[model samples]
Target: MSNELPTVALVRLLEGARYEVMPTASVVDAVGEHVPPSVTVTVTAAPGKGLEATLSTATTLARAGWPVVPHLAARMLTGRGELQEVVARLAEAGVTAAFVPGGDADPPAGDYDCALDLLRDLATMEHPFTQVGITGYPESHPTIDDDVTVQAMWDKRAYATHIVSNMTFDAEHLGTWCERVRRRRVELPLLVGVPGPVERTKLLGMATKIGVGESLRFLRKQKSVFARIAAPGFSSDRFVSRVAALSANPALGIAGLHVFTFNQVGVVETWRQGMLARAREERVHPTGRGGHQDG
Candidate 1:
């Protein structure tokens, strides 16, 4: 294991680094300006905006020569017919990857209530998608129990190509969870969710609205979520630095860092560039002081 873990993590992070974007139209320009075409981009779905918003954003990104993965929220689709239409649209737009999430919708619009149910339907389709991603909750889920989350991962193993973990600040918790997942014999590559340089104020509001909000509520009931968010400034530095330690072990199958930019691509991109530059300087001058630099 290297004594300087972040150095190694930086390389892994930049390799096929994923930036998640929402359906907002302005995001297309923001992502184009900040995110490199080399990095994979993911489009998130919102119940209010509908799945078309996500698909259109993804299609635009794909057309712009960016590899995009759109979120297929099971609750949003009407039925298998809708799924096929979506698959066709994605195929036509050149999006070969997708992320399947159970979604936060209270009342599902279709027969597919969960991601697994959607995955089962997708398997029946002769779609063009080559890579399918499923969500993973390293920490306890907001709605589902820990055991259920684990079982869900196992159930979707056949359909999903990889697992993208939800937000978790604790590296120890993530590492331990990965170990347990391996113990269960599900060896799919795991993409750990790492937040970029997003503002605390902006995050609190958005987090409360996204699935992160539910997780926050669950954490609050357990009496551990308030302290962290209440603290003024927030950065991915500490969390990413800690997670760097896990890269030392290849058996963990930690594929790469999937950054939750939350559509704050400008700041996140600046932070990523600064980190890469810092890593380079550190390689040349190992003894120099290197503090956390997140814009």
Candidate 2:
């Protein structure tokens, strides 16, 4: 592939891609006008709003003809029955994908404690979902140590079909983390997380309120996050370019991107279309054989 392939492939990955949405009151309406029927929008589990809110929102989106992936926070499940109900609900709606994570609820809501346990349960249940995703930490999770996260990834490898990395502005950190995953032989395809253009104040406030601890710590450790946050609105060009440059090898198995829209659906949609248009004008062609340039 040529030097331009990385950016081109990155744009291809962004096309008709997945964007995450929080299940707030205005979320559905916010996404209604902007998100197309073909794109997948993963509804996040909010501790304050409850898992029902997340699943309900996801099911609604799925019914409306959009492919939806809802966050099934393990802490929210009470037992096999609740899991079965959720599974049945998804099947009824024809939703085929989900993102499972150990939610940040203090004193977990029920029997399940972590994602692994819930994944085990899901494996045993007869469910409609074929694509199940687990979380990955690039700059290290704020609550868990790095080593534990590595082992957890290895353990969850059997249950998870893909890994959606938590949001991070440090491209180098993501590069190193992906390399480590390769060394460990965790073969799950990666979905790099990037936040779309959003208001600085709203972004910070949401990040803090959502308990994405790494976002706050990353802001302090990596100046890039702060720089973007300090700006009028966040633009993913710099962050996406650096990460794509570092992950230019197909061997890295980065399947696509996962944008943390944070319900900024309209702004994110505009940004994505602009990036795709720019890539086309630049003629960032990639040879079919070496789709990714040498990393």
Candidate 3:
């Protein structure tokens, strides 16, 4: 049995598949411990807060020699001139990509109501980013109608380089959504969202502090049926495996995993390394010549 891990193969998988590995300022040190310098880490500004905070996080991380992508939430910018300043700061820090979500910011700061609107504004900017990622909902959004969500994606397609799915736990639903995106002619590569390797207790703590429980409620309400999230743990292993399986399917066009590290960077990195090791070993084992050993 060949238990050797293929470094090149895994590197390609990581590079091709991953969208954003989110790391918060509170856990910036943890990011240094876990995330490889090769992967881009996206630092998020608290929604509705000004771009200064997000830019600061991105600047710090970029200075640390890590490729950093800042989330430029829609409601954060004051105007076109403010947008230019934000872009200039990001460019100065060597950030080539950013994630723009219709921020939860109430009453909006400027003209943009949603991500699509922000994308429109960004397209007109002189310093347009080479790579811009937009949110995709495999599950229905809490407040938005399904038809509207679909239409919004179509509208943003020209501005977006990739689609990063919002966090959804159901793999079957995710697979189906990938098909839907393809059917709708959404050719942008997808980064399947998965919760990271945080234990249930700790995740609950962070979720409460970060208002994630409310977000989870929003997701559950959008789902066809409510699910009691399986007990005592959060792991991206199954989520990553489901995504890797989809890589064999030519039609879905799954690009990679976007781990919602939720500030649990160290544990998530450990989980990824372990799975990649197992996957590599399984691929080489003589006993399982044609079978997926990881399964």
Candidate 4:
């Protein structure tokens, strides 16, 4: 059992679980209560309402003592001055990491159109972070062409410290994508992304509100492949279990799980704790190789 601990013991070592939350509701209250004090919590604000919203959320979270990582959506930044201001404000709040993405905003406000551009701008400003996370698409992006997306990632690798995969449901696809990343020499550590502990009803509501429902409907008109997309978005215990399967392999270079909590922080925290306890128990009593049965 002592020897078995190393195989499964890591399951309980989630001292700094990372959670992504939207700026809705009383986020600080939720963070203070449900989120463990040791964990890092990120709040995201997209392009519509602008960078002010993101900075406000970042400020509040920093004051609350969570290591805050705000998403610096490329399209949202208006110009070099705005970008500099954002970096300065974040630095003031003690933010060390930022996830840059080519945001979904229509009509770019500045010269930057994609995350790569933003990365370049930030580099020129000499404002490097302790961690810079760039998005990776294991599953195809709805808007970008596959070839362009992969090339964009390779080009951005030098500026990023890690790659956080966008939402992916298929474990096999994720594994394959990881192999492709290695084959391409994109050496940044990966943080597997998945939805967290959201109820089906809530997920559906969010999807509808965010217009993902319309996108899926459009896809359905094109091909039967859209059937999978028809289902409401929600986290799968099965998916988490599958990802956990890779825990023992250092060669995988997986940093950890990145949960897009969608402000369902309380629920995911409980789920994380339960999984940790189960894995800890498995460690006490030896589990099969890879803990496949335990999962």
Candidate 5:
């Protein structure tokens, strides 16, 4: 494929991208101030604040006219009753999408142990959500093996509408993982997870406090990931351009980007706008070089 194909694809992907924010105190205001209502915002569930934080933030965003998708952590709920209530709450708030992940809570807070368990129950209920997403790992999960993660996706395929890959910096790993998913026949469309223009110090601090086992462990294990983020001239624009070519393959099922903003909503939004503007310019002008200049 010519260089323009990926640049064109990057433009389309950025245009439809969604932002993921933690359920922080200032998140709603920050998102409201920076992100336009046209963009979809997803609220993350954390063990420290519990599910309520995610739901409340999501409801607030929804009421304010931004499309919202709340993460429903399986291990956070006590049982079916709690799940029902949560679903009812989201329905009342007009939330149309949900992303289910096996939570970080050690010892399992309730009857659910993994996302598939919660997804199974969700399938049985007349839930209000029109779209449901499950996690996909481009790199090996900190705990689960590659085969196990792939099998988990296959098992949950009946319930999930799409797959949101975990944050990854390696474009080669991402491309290989996409091929693996297709070879295994887990056909759900993917929203590639990419970190926004987050500050390294802030991101590390928040990750520690949030206590997400997978994220923290992944960070600890991959020292190079930290190095890259902490590197002087780091910009997600370069990473996105490297992987943007994969989206051109229909068989890969690359839907769009799911940007992990880490509550840096304003900065992330600025970066998104800059990238969109640049990608569009490249598309229109036909620079002939596949890659975009780092900002």
Candidate 6:
């Protein structure tokens, strides 16, 4: 809670943060123009755009010399054959990491029902991705129970390298969730997800375009986040600082950040740079604040 702790944590997180963007038409260009090769770029897979779009964007980014991590939605793949093809393509593109989510597809598109199922299948493949990330929900899921989500992470531990937590504005909840994950013995490091500096209207529009289910899920489960985003002069600076403070406890295994850019790569990159600069500045000249400081 000391000023030094959060200032240092914020610098660490910002230095190694990864940007997650939807596979929209302008996303590749946005990332190429705004993001550097140092920051990893993650592409999302949505039912509306299909898995192909996700792969295409990832491959393109990889080819452009960026570290790319693609989301392979379990429900999007037909079976192992399709999964194999997907892996082969990523391998060809030199992508070494991936994130697998159960996906929002209703009645699932194939053999795998959950992320665990796809992860299990991936384990059988020869030389699959070196790093696999699974979703973690800090807040209650719209459909799944809170306990079930934690258990799901436990069940997928063998197959996943880390956990990318779902975005939440509640820093308290996020900190508690990290403690809960540690308590359950899910030792995989966590990449806390947070929204980038995106406009509320733009974010909402993109969410709606992705899928009605996803939009509904966001509206229903992230009401607080929505309210925060809609507020005038909304910024993630304070939220990220609070989340970063958790890193002071090594037991939490707060790896870094996973920024949901919502395809607003330019603004997000600028915001990140500004935050990192401020954190570095604070680290050098201690403000002497005893407790945590909110943005």
Writing each residue's lDDT as its tens digit, candidate 5 over 79-182 gives 78899999999899899999999987777789999999999999999889889999999967777898899999999998989999988888888988999999
Higher-scoring candidate on TM-score, 3 or 5:
5
lDDT, residue 34, model 1: 80
Q: Per-residue lDDT tens digits of candidate 3, residues 228-275?
A: 234433235555555566655657776667776666777667767777
RMSD to the true structure for each prediction, in A, is 3.9, 4.8, 4.7, 4.4, 2.7, 2.6
Quote each prediction's TM-score.
0.87, 0.86, 0.84, 0.85, 0.92, 0.92
> lDDT tens string, model 6, 121-181?
8999964588999999986777899989989999999998999988877788788889888
Give residue 270's lDDT in candidate 1 (0 to 100): 83
lDDT of each: 0.79, 0.78, 0.67, 0.71, 0.86, 0.85
| TM-score computed on alpha carbons, candidate 4 | 0.85
Question: Where does model 2 exceed 4 Å of error?
Answer: 1-4, 204-228, 231-235, 284-295
Between candidates 4 and 5, the one scoring higher on TM-score is 5
In candidate 6, which residue ranges exceed 4 Å CA deviation? 1-4, 208-224, 232-234, 290-295
Candidate 3 wrong stretches, greater than 4 Å? 1-25, 48-50, 208-235, 286-295
- Cα lDDT of model 1 by residue, 12-118, tens digit: 55555789877775789988888889888999887767788898899999999999999999998888999999999989988999999998666899798899999
Which stretches in model 1 have alpha-carbon errors above 4 Å? 1-6, 204-235, 288-295
Candidate 2: clashing pairs of residues: none
TM-score of 3: 0.84
Tell me the deviation in Å of residue 9 in model 2. 1.0
